[model samples]
Target: MNVPELFEEGWYWTSTQYSPNLAWSQSFDDGLQGNLVKDYEGRVRVVRRFPLN
Candidate 1:
């Protein structure tokens, strides 16, 4: 997702499903070093350091 230059934050949505027959669960990396940040309202505000480079 592309954010405006004026903002230091961005957002997006995703969906996935898992199969019960699979021996291992799906896993991936965003190359970030931090956990998800949340607002006072308990909504996700930022996903820390999702490195693309």
Candidate 2:
């Protein structure tokens, strides 16, 4: 998959929940996966999956 033109360099929330107060996040800048507080400000990317038939 290719990165979108409007991609921003920062941490983005994932669907995975790390804990009651933390969640999984990914960094677009360096492709790092980490956890961040639920209340912290972050970016999000809306995407959909398609079958490779």
Candidate 3:
């Protein structure tokens, strides 16, 4: 299940914010969800949303 070609095994930040200084993050290595400080750097994927018209 470790597909390096698809995504690297590391923590990825999300748009969810726990506080002004904390945000949500997910671990690609173990599929765990948690929060982290906004000042810390992590991995992320480009996500785009489109409205249906």
* Top lDDT hit: 2
| lDDT for each candidate structure | 0.29, 0.89, 0.85
Give one digit per residue, the lDDT tens place, for model 3 in 3-48: 4567788999988899999999998889899999998889887656
After superposition, which runs of candidate 3 have C-alpha atoms over 4 Å from their true positions? Answer: 1-5, 48-53
- lDDT winner, 1 or 2: 2
Model 2 agreement with the true structure over 1-53: per-residue lDDT tens digits? 67655678888999889999999999888889999999999988887788776
Worst 10 residues of 1 by lDDT: 22-31
In order of lDDT, best first, we have 2, 3, 1
Question: For model 3, what is the error of residue 49's alpha carbon versus the real structure, in angstroms, after optimal superposition?
Answer: 7.3
lDDT of 1 by residue, 1-53 (tens): 56445333333221222233222111122322222223212112344557687
State every prediction's TM-score relative to the real structure.
0.15, 0.81, 0.72
Tell me the lDDT of model 1 at 12.
Answer: 25
Which candidate has the top score in TM-score?
2
TM-score of 1: 0.15
